[model samples]
Target: MSSRSPAPPNAAPNARAVLAANLIRLRAEKGWSQEALAFECGLHRTFVAHVERQARNISLDNLERLALALGVQTYSLLMP
Candidate 1:
């Protein structure tokens, strides 16, 4: 194994909410529209909008892409 402890209970259930809030906040901070962020991350604009709406879950790769485009660590999207 790994040295890190497991995530606390409720972490998994809240990840989508965390990601949605952060994405919206970060996008606004960058003064970017959903389309702009999607273009930067190579995702569809509706996909970005859906993510911000917490309407769907995405793969780790997409999460990383969004974080990179937002100039943040991958974990940042999953954290509160």
Candidate 2:
């Protein structure tokens, strides 16, 4: 028997949730706050908060900027 929980209705994980989790994890690993990350990525603090909350969709360019600021590959931010 599997120990995993039942899959979500869509079966696939939400991209925004994955991105939010990754961002939170990476930021914690770096000992940075949302404002610090936003400053590093040249984005507004509210924008970073929105991203973390999955309140809005982000652009490819903004995604790339976030990845660059975090020193991670752009694709990693989208990984499930």
Candidate 3:
């Protein structure tokens, strides 16, 4: 038999990409600019852009702040 391990069952998809996509959609839905969202989240606009692009790995605390700014629960960001 081959040595490769079997893939785990019911593994979650990538969290960062899911979060980024949700953030982008929510911002668009609200008609808010990245700068505006960042301000509301107490974060830098550039950082928000990076987060939305999934170029930055955001911490849980920052994710919570962004979720709160978007008027959503933190778990919403992780939704598919």
**Who wins the TM-score comparison?**
2
Residue-level lDDT tens digits of model 2 in 1-75: 534466679888878889999999999999999999999999999999999998878999999999999999999
Rank by TM-score, descending?
Answer: 2, 3, 1
TM-score of each: 0.82, 0.87, 0.83
Question: Which candidate, 2 or 3, would have the higher lDDT against the true structure?
Answer: 2
Error of 2 at 37 (Å): 0.2
lDDT of 2 at 64: 100
Instruction: Kindly provide the TM-score of model 1 when superposed on the true structure, using C-alpha atoms.
Output: 0.82
- Candidate 3 RMSD to the real structure: 5.9
Candidate order by decreasing lDDT:
2, 3, 1
Flag clash pairs in model 2. none
lDDT of 3 at 55: 79
RMSD of candidate 1 to true structure, Å: 7.6
